[model samples]
Target: MNAPTTPSTALDKHTGEPLRPTDGQLALAEAVRNGETRETHGTQTVPASRYTDPAHFEAEKRALFDRLPQVLCPSALLPEPGMAVPHDQTGRPLLITRDKQGEAHVFLNVCQHRGTRLVEGEDVQCSSKLVCPYHAWTYQLDGRLLALPRADTFPGLDKAQYGLKELPSCEAGGLIWFSPQADADFSLAETLGEDFSAFAMEQSFLFRRRTHTVKGNWKLIMDAFLESYHVLRLHANTIGPFFKDGITAGDTVGPHMRSAVGRLEEVEGVDFTDMAALRRVITFAYQLLPATVIVPSPDYVNVMVLMPQAHDLTLVEDFMLIPEAPATDKARDHWERSWALLDGGVFGSEDFRAAELGQQGLESGAVDHITLGTLEGGIKRFDETVQEYLRAVN
Candidate 1:
């Protein structure tokens, strides 16, 4: 903890309503008050094996990816009553369209007759019913079999039994989440708490998308975003000037966590009473458990999702969701230039480069453990939460 940067209050600006920071953020602020910012969680470390073990990775796939509820995409992707899109990670497809009463439903994209994919390609699709290209087996938006081609050829066939497999899904905080298994621990309101509304999730729409196929363990890539300690060094030429080094608050929400750090020059003195000033001084990151990270910025939200491919390989999709459309060509050009900085700078060359090298060292069996300082508490908490989840899974 460090000395108090500013006196604390819990009130919003306009409404004077209560404002709550995540547990992690509050701890960090309190730590700063007590003069423990740089050294609070110092001297903590985890076994290096956790990062390199193939068995552990396999367990993660089963315990976390297969069992828990993870984000499929933003709920805004399929807004219209007949919108459908393929699940990028699974390539198995997902059908999300509303019924007559305007209720959303999700179902498998496979035809029951011959396991043919119902929809193909990348782009939002629209149709009241999905018809398989292979056999013309059709299904309604609600996942009920509407018709099967050549019905008389197949006698004693039950349309109800062959309806597309309905996966248990949840939409809260404006995200579509589901699991491979029959059950999942899912509650959008609970997972994100009040921050769900704070994120303005309903108003957001996908603005940009890019994928990075990197050679590194997924956890290694995630650890890069867990703390602000490296911002001054790795991002020195880029975001380094924008953020304070080793000043952050981390809060754990169930199996997930949130971290917020002050802007570099603004940390020494802050005016918590001025909401605009307060916001200008800090940035927030929501680590959505296993595979997603959402960072809420002033203009847009940054979402990073990792699709694990192997023990030391992962596919990362970075999505930027903005609430408003660009009104003019200049606004559009501004975003284009900003994305160039982002895609090629922070997450691009610097972060992924580090991820690749980190895996090499961890896999070399050279270090027994990775030591973490008090300032690196975010990483410690994140690793612990992950291990906790893995241990509890059955």
Candidate 2:
């Protein structure tokens, strides 16, 4: 682990609050200290078809990913005005931009003139206006149609009606969320905003972001984060030694799951006010509903957005966020090393690899259902919540 960068008792530069644990988080620490963990009544099993069946995948798309609000990207991706990025992982062409007023907007990446894509690749662009390459149709960052090459030819063309088709979107807790539908219902997302804000995510800086294509179901990827049962085995060479076996406590905030992982060696007689000492003993993980995972490290955070494209294919946008941009070469090197270890080594090679392997095994029809033991009860709980949403739509 890298050395601590900030003093423990130092106030948070963003929230101006003590970096102490909350009452609920303290309860989790107490649970860890006392060796208390959550367990189900008995072994629970979810059918293998849940991860392999295409009909079920279609159902999930309609009931959950389609109807609900999902994370598009981090607001820091557009840290300043006149910044835009193209998002195509959701299987929809989307153009996310920050207007001159610094407000984030999500629009269909289609030009109103010829239905051609306004932006081609996934690169982030900085410009006051977006111009369609096919035709010289120009639009402002806010989706307003600014100019057209042959405006005189098309008599009485109302630019207002030809603006880009924008989806309902909002920025909260440092993330940008948008609904697949036209409605703007973000009640659940708003609730999660409070939880993420507690981590000071809104004030975090975007250090690095990468897109990963995982050969597994989106839920399979999500199931990996819901429990630490495989950490000792799957991540043994990477980050396993840092956490104690079966020393995690989890609770659900509405549809989201929150977990506290106890370190291998418990700290004795440590001061609660020392954030560094506290973090050394406890690692927190959050599984935000359908497929966003937020894990806060000692000096940085990882936010992953999982988008399911097929029954066995998932596109993961992994974001590494730091407390602030590295100002010195030494600081930059530290952050870079940290990012390489966690994002590239731990998650990419270990956790995601396990998910893909599980998918292969399940595809062979070797197992009818995957069994979850007491230590993996969080997976059962998350699957049950998913079923409720599916049931509602059915």
- Model number with the top lDDT: 2
Best by TM-score: 2
Counting clashing residue pairs in each candidate, in order, gives: 19, 0
Go through the candidates in order and give each one's C-alpha lDDT: 0.70, 0.84
Q: Candidate 2 residues 238-294, lDDT tens each?
A: 787777464788777778888888743574565644565666677889888678998
Scanning candidate 1 in windows of ten residues, the lowest lDDT window is 1-10
Measured on C-alpha atoms, candidate 1 has an lDDT of: 0.70
Question: Tens-digit lDDT track for model 1 on 157-180?
Answer: 988898888887777766777776
Which residue pairs collide in model 2, if any?
none
Model 2's alpha-carbon lDDT is 0.84
Deviation from native of the Cα of residue 259 in model 2, angstroms: 1.0
TM-score of each: 0.84, 0.93
Task: Kindly provide the TM-score of model 1 when superposed on the true structure, using C-alpha atoms.
Answer: 0.84
